[model samples]
Target: MQIILCESAEQVGRRAADIIEARVRQGPAVLGLATGGSPASTYAELIRRHREEGLRFGDVTAFTLDEYAGLPADHPQSYHSTIRREFVDHVDLDLAKLHTPRGDAEDLVAEAARYDLAIVGAGGIDVQLLGIGANGHIGFNEPTSSLRSRTRVKTLAVATRTANARFFEGDDEEVPKLCLTQGLGTIGESRQAVLVALGSAKAAAVQAMVEGPVSAFCPGSVLQLHPRATIVLDPGAASQLTMLEYYRDAQALNDGLQ
Candidate 1:
């Protein structure tokens, strides 16, 4: 695990984008994308590069991390629509190649199984982008989720639902109680994983993910076991990490080497 402390949230986004852009430039590649505010800036940065720097994603195949159960693919609040609006529509990515879990499938169980198979068929993800939930959940894998879990339906916690209430006109009741999410085991299979966080609101969760013990209670801590996981954060988010100076020193050394 590598902790990269950036001076600001925009830098955190750019750093995350750097990892993704590098993967896309490496011939044909697969990407696992995240939704929500943490990755919004990263998507914006990628869009800027596409327009201004000639960064192309024509050969990239993308997969989104999760979706709200019962929401149609075209629903504005659904991850399917959100991802397209936020990133896909701005890039040259092939719409046919981008995959998202069918949250509204009549047979949701089968949908989850099919989604997992689809990922395997695409050669798995080359790089997976993630956002640590304020409660330390990744995707919709709430605390106590099995570390070896696969793609499946999950019940969203109260906190998770409340946090997402903004997308549903600030009504927690409007937020779906269930969701479909790629599990830790599935995410761990990626060649690399990049997680970005910002602001003081994320400080405790960031600290727990980076410096705390590996446990199901804090699902994001599973990244510590990943062979190629990178945690990008702004100062506010990294404030609670005990090895703050060490991480900064190590990142400086790594930058010099690069």
Candidate 2:
């Protein structure tokens, strides 16, 4: 695991985009994408590079990490729409290559199974991007989620629902209570995992994920088991990590090695 701290959210976004652009350049790559306010700036920077620096995504295959179970793909609050509005629609990638779990499947269990099969068939994700929930959830895998879980429908925790309420016009009741999400094990299967968090609001969870015990209580901490996981944060988000200085020193050493 590696921790990278940036002075500002915008700088973190640029740094993340740089990593993504480099991955996209390495031939056809499968990318695991996340949706939320946290990744908006990174997508914006990617769009900017696509426009100004001639960055191209023609060979990339993208899969979204989760989706509200009952929401239609066209719903404004659906991850499908959010991803399209923020990143996919602005890029030149093939629409046919984009994937998201079927949120409205008649047979949800089968849908989840199919989603897992599709990911495996695509040769697995090369780089999985993530946004840590304030409650330490990743995708929709809330507290106590099985570390070895696969694609499945999960009930949203009250904390997650409340946090997401802003998207539903500040009405917590409007947010979906159920969602389909990739399991921690599925995310860990990716060759590389990149997580982004910002602001003091996420400080505690970020700390727990980085420095606390690796348990289901802090699902994001499961990243500790990934072979090539990287946590990128703005300083405020990284505030509670006790070993922050050591991380910086390690980064300096890695930079010299590179």
Best prediction by TM-score: 1
Over the stretch 1-258, how does candidate 1's per-residue lDDT look in tens digits?
Answer: 998999988898899999998888879999999998999889999999999999999999999999999999999999999999989999999999889999899998889989998999999999999999888999889999999889999999999999999988999999999999999999999999999998889889988999899989999999989999999998888888899889989999999999
What range of 10 consecutive residues in model 2 has the weakest lDDT sum? 102-111
TM-score quality measure for candidate 2: 0.98
Which segments of candidate 1 are over 4 A away from where they belong? none
- After the best TM-score superposition of candidate 1, give how far the Cα of residue 134 lies from its true spot, in angstroms: 1.0
- Candidate 2 local Cα displacement, residue 151, angstroms: 0.7
Most lDDT-accurate candidate: 1
Which RMSD values do the candidates have, in order?
0.7, 0.8
**Whole-model Cα lDDT of every candidate shown, in order:** 0.93, 0.91
Task: State how far residue 37 of model 1 sits from its true place (Å).
Answer: 0.3
Error of 2 at 63 (Å): 0.4
lDDT of 2 by residue, 1-258 (tens): 888889998988987887888899889999999999778879999999999999999999999999998888889999988899899999898889999987888887888889998999999999999999999999999999998889998999999999999999999999999899999889989999989998999999999999999999999999999999988899989998898779999989986897
Question: Could you estimate the TM-score for every candidate?
Answer: 0.99, 0.98
